[model samples]
Target: MTHGGGGALYLLLILILVSIPVTLIWLFHGQGNARKRRAIGFSQIAIFAIAIILFFSGVSYLQNIGFVAGFIVLIAMLITPVVFKNRV
Candidate 1:
């Protein structure tokens, strides 16, 4: 059971890390459409933000919760703009 839990925690960490680049691309590319892109960006941000909050709070709710998930979410938030930056 403990091993399964550890594996879950690790998988979650990897998912979070992968989400970083995906979310950033989603936000940036979504911007081209303005209304559509902005909405997509906002939703992506909200999802990541909530994920981060939940990840941290999960530490109290469940032992062995990984912090890497939250860190990756944070990185996604930071990279969103760079990926979305206007290009000529």
Candidate 2:
């Protein structure tokens, strides 16, 4: 009946997953935005989704890779809009 930090980590991932779309809508909203920019904006959602799927799967190496990838995607999420903003 005692679960340690698993629930907390799950919540963290859920927060991250939710933040991606929120950030996309908030940061990228404007007239004359390009489809390419929108694609880049939404890629974080796909990245985190795959990361979570891989992280939870049975393959140990994939889980580690996914864990690392998730963090990398988090950083990219912060940086991506800035990088792509000039094109919008």
**Which has the greatest TM-score?**
2
1-88: candidate 2 lDDT, tens digit per residue: 1256356567567758766765576456734566766676667778888998998888878877777788778767766666655656
Count of backbone clashes for each model?
2, 0
Q: Per-residue CA lDDT of candidate 1, range 39-70, in tens? A: 65677667666655665563555332334545
Give each model's whole-structure lDDT: 0.58, 0.69
List where candidate 2 sits over 4 angstroms from the true fold: 1-22, 26-32
Off by over 4 Å in 1: 1-3, 30-32, 58-88
**Model 1: lowest-lDDT 10 consecutive positions:** 58-67
Count backbone overlaps in model 2: 0
Instruction: Provide TM-scores for the models.
Output: 0.48, 0.66
Task: Give the Å shift of residue 32 in candidate 2.
Answer: 4.9
User: In model 1, how large is the Cα lDDT of residue 58?
Assistant: 37
Winning model by lDDT: 2
